[model samples]
Target: MRATSQDTAGGVRRTRNAAQTREALLQVASRRFARDGYASTTVREIADEAGVNVALISRYFASKEGLFEACLAAAVTDLRRDAGDTSLEAIAPSIARRMVGATSDGGRLPDTLLLLLRSSGDEHVDNVRREFLQSLSERMAAASPAGPETLLRAQILLATTLGMALLRTSMSIQPLAAATEQDLLGPVSDLVDALLAEKR
Candidate 1:
């Protein structure tokens, strides 16, 4: 059956409206999460700020934790894309540049990441950290040699990245933050190379 022009127009309008609503929800959630922190921000509050129903928030994000995880996952993935593959020697520096770029993008990360860092003593934070480390291990294991050397490299790589992330995003120490991208990555890359040189 062929649809009339009016019917097609209505369908398009509905899709456009839904997209706008989703974008609005994400923008509001990002701002609220950044400003109030994940633990402090409630779904109801976010929905209220977005002028959407509480039910709509659940429908979109399932839960507050889910929303925060989604946002972090998104931020991490974007950084990964920017980092690319700069070889094990150069990866650290590339990653440092990418981290600085991502953080300084005037986005939601600075505030939201600080919130996560402050909440590091929380059980959920530990669980999330474990999950993140395990995820990184799985990726490295899939790509690298299955030996102590590769495992050590994976551990060092992850630790370096996590430390940089915490320092840049959470600690916000002026000297650490002021360090040039290469200045930070040089030591990290050396550490990674040393780890990679280790044998089982």
Candidate 2:
């Protein structure tokens, strides 16, 4: 049978409400997971902050684990879109700037990285972290597909980028943190260039 007008209206309302709740939960959960970590943050806390029912956590995200994963996925998607290609030049100057709070939502980069780092002890988080690393490695490898040592090169390149992110934000290293975006971009771009340039 075709749906009635009331049925269609109700369905639309439900869809809109679900979308709003999911967005609210993500906005709160992202900050909480980043600040308090996965194990420490409760579903109730996320729900309360989002001004929704605690049950919404289960209804919308299934569980705290699911919500955590969703947060990671959303953040990664945003970064990939914002950063453009994973190219060394594309990453450091453009992406790196966004990571270091050079823009409004740019701070999410460090937040997500730190969240993953802090949550690494958990088995699920470990798997997710591995997947995240592997994806980046693949992209990096593809960028220099001619090399026999693509995997190693990718690992080194990522390590450099991750270290710079930590020092500039998480570790709160002043020289790097205080440096102007242009100055920081130069060194990072050069480092990435050298890494990409080497075959051995």
Candidate 3:
């Protein structure tokens, strides 16, 4: 009538395996979506790459759209974790340091940035991406010294980082792509001071 210790251990193992499967799907789906674009990637490809049942995608994410959204959320969460509780004054410099340090053996964009940059073609998914960027801008504005242009400044700061990531990683533009942290930190810090620092 009651479950034994062995049964309980089996349940725990099953739960752990489910979590692993879900993560595997997400990881493969993120890369596929980034490399192939959303419309071109298929549930079967993701499952095959992750070594999971195709039905698991529907079970875990409901649909490909849901999986894409989850991947975007994970990417944003990773960027936030890397940024930590950085102050407005430190935002640009912090981002620049990370950007310059980022490396990809194939010269591809980092999965996080690529996920955000790649288009999904679905209106709803595209809107979700824009909304994430807008919310990020709002958070940056809230952290900056209050002014009429605070939001505008925050958006510009966001644009600056996004552009740098695209050029340095995706485009592999010269000098910028090869730049070191020291090469970027001073300029980025100056930009932050001009954009967000309280006038004195």
Best by lDDT: 3
Candidate 2 lDDT by residue in tens digits, 94-133 = 6457655632443456675555555625577568777877
- C-alpha lDDT values of all predictions: 0.56, 0.68, 0.75
Please state the error at residue 142 of candidate 2 in Å: 2.5
Question: Higher lDDT: candidate 1 or 3?
Answer: 3
Off by over 4 Å in 2: 1-16, 101-107, 118-125, 178-180
Candidate 3 residue spans exceeding 4 A from truth: 1-16, 53-55, 100-110, 121-124
State in Å the error of residue 102, model 2.
Answer: 7.4
Over 4 Å off in model 1, which ranges? 1-17, 27-37, 44-56, 72-83, 103-132, 138-147, 197-200
Model 1 residue 199 CA deviation in Å: 7.9
RMSD of 3: 6.7
How would you order the candidates by TM-score, starting with the best?
Answer: 2, 3, 1
Collision pairs in model 3:
none
Better of 2 and 3 by lDDT: 3
Candidate 2 local Cα displacement, residue 152, angstroms: 1.5
Per-residue error for 143 in candidate 1, Å, reads 7.1
* Lowest lDDT 10-residue stretch of candidate 3: 1-10
How well is each residue in 1-200 modelled by candidate 1, as lDDT tens digits? Answer: 22222223234322225455555676677656655566677887877786655666666677776666655555445444544453454555655565555443345334433333333234664566466556654555344443645766676676666666567655577777667766767676676555553344
Model 3: per-residue Cα lDDT over 98-175, one tens digit each = 775542222223556677877766787788778878887887888888588999998998888888877776577999
How high is each candidate's TM-score? Answer: 0.58, 0.72, 0.71
